[model samples]
Target: MWSGDELDLDAYLARIGYDIGRDGELAPDVRTLTALHRAHVAAIPFENLDVALGRQVPLDLKSLQGKLVDRRRGGYCYEQNSLLAAALERIGFQVAGRGARNRSRGATLPPVTHAVLAVTIDGEQWLADAGFGWQGVLEPVPLRAGARVEQSGWTFGIGVEDEGIHVLRSLRPEGWTDLYAFSPQTLYPGDFTVMNHYSSSHPQSRFLGQVVAQRPGADVRRALVRETLSSVRADGSAEERIVDTADLAVTLEAEFGIELDSEERARLERLHAAGV
Candidate 1:
C-alpha cells in the first residue's frame, strides 16, 4: 500500500495543480475528491511512451512520483490510478484497487487489463478512475445501479449487467457505449504487477508497437495515436490530421507536453514511419 510519507505530498499536490490551503478545507469530502480528480487528469496525461520505447513501466510509488510528478511525464492507467489511489489514501479517503475488462464491443469475458478505484467517502461508495484516456469519467460517481453523471458536456452511467459485473457506459450519438466491465473483486498489488508486466512487455500487447498519449483540457481533448493527432471538442466534434515524420518530436512536445531525447525521438519516428 502507498502511504503519504512514501512520497512528497506537497510536490504531488503541486504537480496536480491543486491548492490545499486555498480551498480552506482539508477534509476528504466530495468537493476535495472531485477537485483532485479533475486536477490529476488535467495535469498528468495518459501516455504509453515507455512501452513504445521498450522501457519497463515501474509501479512503485517512488518511481511513479519521480516520473510523473518530478519529471512532469504522463503514464497509462496503472501508473495514473495507482498514484491517485495513494494520494487519496494519504488524504484520508478509503480506497481499494479494482480491475476491469475492456468491453467496447460488449465482449463478455475480456481480460482484466484496466485498473480502477472504488472509494468510500462519507458512507457512500464512488468510482474514480484517472487513466481512461480521452473518454474517461471526469468525476467520481456514486456506485449505484442506474446512476448517471454529466461531466464537461459528456454523460456517463454506471450499472450492473446480468452477470453481476459492473459496467460503465458513455452516452454517444447512436447510443450508450460500454466502456468496460469488472466485478467487485478487490485487486492486490501483485495482481497489478502481473498485468502491468504483460501490458508493457508482452510481444502481443497492443501498447508495444503503438504510441498513445491523451490529455483533456477545459474545452478540448487531445489524443495522439501513432502518427495521427486528434482534437475532440466538448460538443463531440473532432478534427484529425496525420503528423509529418519530421515534425513528430516538435508536435509531441508542443501539443502533448511530452519531451523525449534525440535518440528516443528518432526511434519513435522510425517506428511510426515504418507503420509496423
Candidate 2:
C-alpha cells in the first residue's frame, strides 16, 4: 500500500502547473480532479526515455518526484500513474491502484502490464489514468457501464463485460475501439515493482529498445515512435511524417519537450541506426 503522508504536495502541484490556492479550498471533487488530470497530461509528457536509455524506472514517491518533477522528465505507465496516485492521495482523495491487460486491437492479451487508479469521491467511483500514452482517456470517467465522457472533442466510455471486467472504449469515425480491460482488484506496491522490472528490461518488452514520446494538447496529440512523427487530431484525423536522423534530437526536444543529453542523444541515434 502506498501512503501519501510524505508526498511533497506543493512541489507536485507546481510540477503539474496546478494552482490549488486559486480555488481557495482543496476539495476532492470531480471538477478539481478533471482540472488536475488535464494539467498533468499537458505539462508532463508520456515517454519511455529511461527505458530507452536502459535504466530501471523507479516507483518510489521520492524517486518519482525527483525524476518527473524536479528534473522535468516523463515516464511510462507505471511511473506516471504512481506519481499521480501519490498526489491525489495526499489531497484527501480515496485512491486504489489497479492493474490491467492490454486489450487494444491486434494486441495480444499479455500479463497485466498497465497500472490505473480507481478513485472514490462523494460516493461515486471514477477511473483515472494519467499514463496511457496516445489513445488514453483524457479525463476521469465514472466507473459505470455505458457512462460516456467527452474530452477535447473525443468521446470515451466504460462498459462492463462478462465476469465483471471493465473495458474502456473510445469512439472513432469507424466505431468504438477497446483501449484496455481491468478488474477492481487492488494491486500492492510489490506487484508493480515486479511488473516494472519486466517492462523496463525484458528483451521483447516494447519499452526496451523503442523511443516513444507523447504530448496531448487541447486539439491534437503529438507522438513520436522511432523516426515517425504523428499528429492525431481529436476529430479522428491524423498526419504523419518520417523524421530524419539528423533532425531526431531537435524534433524530440521541440515536439515532445524532451531535451536529451549528449550521451542519451547518441544512444538513440545508435538505436535508430540499428533499426531496433
Candidate 3:
C-alpha cells in the first residue's frame, strides 16, 4: 500500500542511476533489489535541510518525488525510506515498513523513529534500508539471525536480542558497534507521518536546529553535523573540519551532492550562520 502505481517508476530508476543494461533488469529478486538499494544511497544523499530551514517536510508521493527526484535534493530517513519503499513496491517487490530505535548514541535506548524496509524475495526476506545516513548498509542485509554482509571492505552483521528484537551492527576496529535495533512489528506510512511530525517540528529534535548531511561510501563515510564535517575511513580513523557559513552552499553541493536553488540556499546560509 505504498501507492507504488502512482510513483513515476522510470523517473525513480533514472534518479538512482539504475541501468538495465549494466545493473540488471527490473524484477522482484535479490539482484535487482541489491542494485536499487545500493544505487539509491549512492546517488541520493542523506540530509535534513528543510527541517533546519523551518519548512514542512511532506511525505506525500508527489512531494517526495518533486523534492527528491525532480529537485535532486536529499532528505532524512522518513523521506528517504518512503521513496525507496514506493520504488521497490512499484517494481513488483513486496515491501513493508519497520520502525527502528536509534542505539548508536549510547546505552540509553531511544524511541522508535527510523524507518526501514523489509523486502521479501521468494521465500527469503531481506533488510533493505536506503536511508540511515552515514552508518547504513550499501545493500540489503538478509533478515535472519547472525546475518553477516561485507560491502566492499566494510562489514555489517545482524544479531537477535531478547523479545524478538533485531539489531543491526557494524564491525569497527575495536569491536562490533550497534547502529540501531528494530522490532518485528511492521509500521505503516501513517505511523511514519506521526513520527515525522515530532522529528521535523519538535524543539528538542536533533534535526530541528542542525545542518546534517551524510554520505557513506565504500571507501569513506562523511557526515556534516552542524558546522563540523567529519570523514571516517574503513579503519575507523576520522578527520573533521569546520564548515563555515560562507562555505555552506558549496560544501553541500560539492561534498554531499545536494544542490539548492537561490532561495533555498539563501535561507540555509542564514541558518548556518546563526549556528542553528
Candidate 4:
C-alpha cells in the first residue's frame, strides 16, 4: 500500500528529527500524525531547483528516498508529499493523494498541479500536507468544513466550495487568504506522475523556467522564486528583495535549509545568468 515497505522508516524519522518514532512507538494516531507533519515541514524544505535545471522529478519511492532523504535535498509538492505518504503508510496510517489547484497566485484558477495527502484516524480524515511550501499548515488540518487550527501561532482553516471542493486557507492580518483548493477525489501515484511530467517539462509550467524554494515558518514564511526573495510575516506585512546570483546558494541554505553540490550549484548559477 503506497510502497510503504520500501521506505526507510528509521532514516526518514531521523531526517525529520522525529524521535518518538525511533523507539518504535510511532502510532498511526493523530498525535503522531500531527507531530510528524510538523517536524517534516520544518526539516525538509520545498524547492523546484531540479525542474529549473531541466531534470525530471521522479515520484517512485526509491527515487524519492534517494533525492529527498539520502541526498538531503528539497522537492516540490509531488515529491515531498509522496515521501510523506510513504512514511505514513509504513506506519500503518491510511493515506491517499489529492490533487489541488493553487489559488494564491491570483483570481484565475490554476490547474490541479499540487499534490496533498488525507489521513484517516478512527474513521476521521485529516488533511496532512508537507509539500505546500510557503503557505502550508504546520499540523494536520481537519478535513471538514469550517475547521480551524492554530499551529505555532500561525492560524489556518478549511472552507467548503462549490462541487464539494475543500479550500485550504491561512489567516493573515488582513483576512483569510486561499492557499489552494482540493476536491475529495482521491488520486493515485500514477496520477502524480502524469502531473509531474507537465510540471517538469511543459513549456508553460511555472517551474520549468525558474527556481522556486520555500519555507513556511511560524513567525515568517520565505519564498525564493527565480531572482527574488520574498518574506511574509504573520502580520500579513511582506517584503521582496532581489537575490543576486552570487548570494543565491547562501540564501537557499540559510533561509530554506537547502544545500546543493558544487556542480549543481554551478549549474543553477549558470541558469540564473542565462536569465531563467
Highest lDDT scorer: 3
Winner by TM-score between candidate 4 and candidate 3: 3
Can you write out model 1's per-residue Cα lDDT over 149-207, one digit (the tens) per residue?
A: 88888888998977678889988777888899888888876777888998999886778
Please give, for residues 1-276, the per-residue lDDT of candidate 2 as tens digits.
465777888888888888767744567889888888878888888999888888778899889988899888888888888888887888888888888888774667688889889989998999999988888877898999999988889899999988789998988888888888999788877788888998998887888787889876768888898888999887788999998778888988898777888998998888876767
Top candidate, metric TM-score: 3
- Displacement of residue 178 (Cα, Å) in model 2 is 0.4
Which regions in candidate 1 have their CA more than 4 angstroms from the true location? Answer: 105-109
Clashing pairs in 2: none
Worst 10 residues of 3 by lDDT: 108-117
- Compared with the true structure, all predictions reach lDDT values of 0.85, 0.85, 0.91, 0.89
Tens-place lDDT per residue, model 4, 135-192, is 8988899999999998877899999999989999988887889999999999999999
Instruction: List, in order, the clash count of every candidate structure.
Output: 0, 0, 0, 0
Which of the predicted structures, 2 or 4, would earn the higher lDDT when compared with the native?
4
Identify the runs in model 4 with alpha carbons over 4 angstroms from their true place. Answer: 21-24
* Residue 165 Cα positional deviation in candidate 3, in Å, after optimal superposition: 0.3
lDDT of predicted model 4? 0.89
Cα error of candidate 4 at position 195, Å: 0.9
How far residue 257's Cα lies from its native spot in candidate 1, in Å, is 1.6
- Supply the TM-score for candidate 2: 0.95
Rank list by TM-score:
3, 4, 2, 1
